[model samples]
Structure formats: C-alpha cells, structure tokens
Target: MSVKGIQPIVSEYHLLWEALQHYQERLEKFSSMSTDEDQQLKYDEKLQDMDGLLRSIKLAAKNDYQLDLK
Candidate 1:
C-alpha cells in the first residue's frame, strides 16, 4: 500500500492509544483518591495489569508491524 493508504491506519492507532492512556490516567487518579486499602490494592493490581498489556501491545506493534507507537 501507498503512504496515503497507511496514514489513516496509523492515525487511528495513535488515537486509540491516546484514549487508552487517558483512561489509565483517570484510573490512577481514582485509585489514589480511594481511602480503602483493599480497594486501593485492587486498583493498583489493575493498573499493573494494564501497564503490562500496554507494553505488550506496543512491543507487538513495533516488532510485528514496525510501527512506533510512541
């Protein structure tokens, strides 16, 4: 495909990534504000899990598609 064909796909990927990052930040803020230890722990675990997922996705994009998600 030509560069024109790839631009939209690249743009979409970046937009999706930005949205995911926004949600992650919001989750972190919510987690920090929580007063309950147990809930905070759960939120922390979720954040870690999300971090792993994001990293995995970024790596896959770079390795498989040669796309730099950053």
Candidate 2:
C-alpha cells in the first residue's frame, strides 16, 4: 500500500541490516572456533567482504533515496 511502490525496497533495506547482523554473529562463531592466531586472521579477512558490501549498501541508500540509514 505504498504510494509509489517503494515499500518493498524499504523492507529490503531492513532485511539487509538483519543480514549484516547475522553475518557478524557467524563471524564471532568462527572466531571462537579458531584456537590459533593464524586461524583467526583467516576468518578476520572474511569480514572485509561483508563490510564492503554494507558500505556499498549504505551509500546506495543515501545516494539513491536520500535515506539516512540507522
């Protein structure tokens, strides 16, 4: 019931936030399972991808819709 069909995209924004949180939780689990420093570093690198994606999403929201995330 959005005026211009924007509701779905708005929902997508929130879902992306949830996805980011879920990814962080998974990263924490991976860290806990890593017993050595080198093992932890490997998992740490995995966050770079997620962080990059989040930054991109935030930028898109602001630039495309002038929406302030969070």
Candidate 3:
C-alpha cells in the first residue's frame, strides 16, 4: 500500500496504544486503593473493556491487515 493509505492505520494504532496506556494506569491505581465490592466490580469491568479492545485489535489484524502487536 502507498504511504497515504497507511496513514490512517498508523494513526489508529497510536490512538489505541494511548487508550491502552490510560487503562493500564487506571488499573494500577485501582490496585492500590480500597477493595470495596463496588470498586472491585468497576475494576473488573475496566479489565473487560481492555480485553475487548485487545480482541478488536486482533480481529482487525486477522481480517484487515497484518499487525505486529507484540
């Protein structure tokens, strides 16, 4: 593909990386906080959201283009 065609994919990858980093930071912060049931649930949901994001990325890589996530 031409450079122009690849630009959007690169931009999307960067955005996804940023979002994953934000979620990682939040999960780390949550780890040090109180383990109340509600908080735990929220933390679990956040983890699921992260997993969903990852799955989407993998799916895109499989169906759309080759992505070296590792």
Candidate 4:
C-alpha cells in the first residue's frame, strides 16, 4: 500500500519522540540495575507513565493530525 502525502514536521512530534527515547533509555538502565521494594514501586510507576505517554503520543498523532505514526 502507498503512503499519504507530506506529513507535518511539528515540534510536538519531535519532542514526543525524544521524550519516548529518553524514557526508553531510562527504563533500560533501571531494568539492568537492582532495586529495593520502595525503588521497585517507583520504577514500576515510571514504566506505567511511559506506557501511557507512548499511547497518548500515538493517539495524538492519529487523531489530531490524521497521521498514523506507526
């Protein structure tokens, strides 16, 4: 299937992408290290936040701009 025309190069898109990358790297680092009970809870929360952020970014790209970023 063919792709659409030009997609808007918006700052929000780039910012979201960068933020995702940042979170992903942090998550990887956290995964590699050991955590105590309290730290584990915080890490889990952060992972959830990252998941939500990713979903929001994907939804925003599709709904707000009609761009299927995936």
lDDT of 1 at 1: 27
TM-scores of all predicted structures: 0.73, 0.67, 0.60, 0.64
* lDDT minimum window of 10 residues, candidate 3: 1-10
Model 1: worst 10 consecutive residues (lDDT sum): 1-10
Q: Which stretches of candidate 4 lie over 4 Å from their true place?
A: 1-9
Between candidates 1 and 4, the one scoring higher on TM-score is 1
TM-score comparison, 2 vs 4, better candidate:
2
Separate clash counts for every candidate: 0, 0, 0, 0
Tens digit of lDDT per residue, candidate 3, span 1-70? Answer: 2233443375676577677868867886885584797887788788778877777665564445566554
How high is the lDDT of residue 29 in model 3? 81
lDDT of all predictions, in order shown? 0.74, 0.72, 0.65, 0.66
Better of 1 and 3 by TM-score: 1
Candidate with best lDDT: 1
Candidate with best TM-score: 1
The full ranking of all candidates by lDDT, starting with the best, is: 1, 2, 4, 3
- Residue 70 accuracy (lDDT) in model 1: 64
Q: Give the per-residue lDDT digits (tens) of candidate 4, residues 1-59.
A: 01353343556676766778688778767855846767766777888887787776776
Candidate 1 collision pairs: none
CA error at residue 2 for candidate 3, angstroms: 19
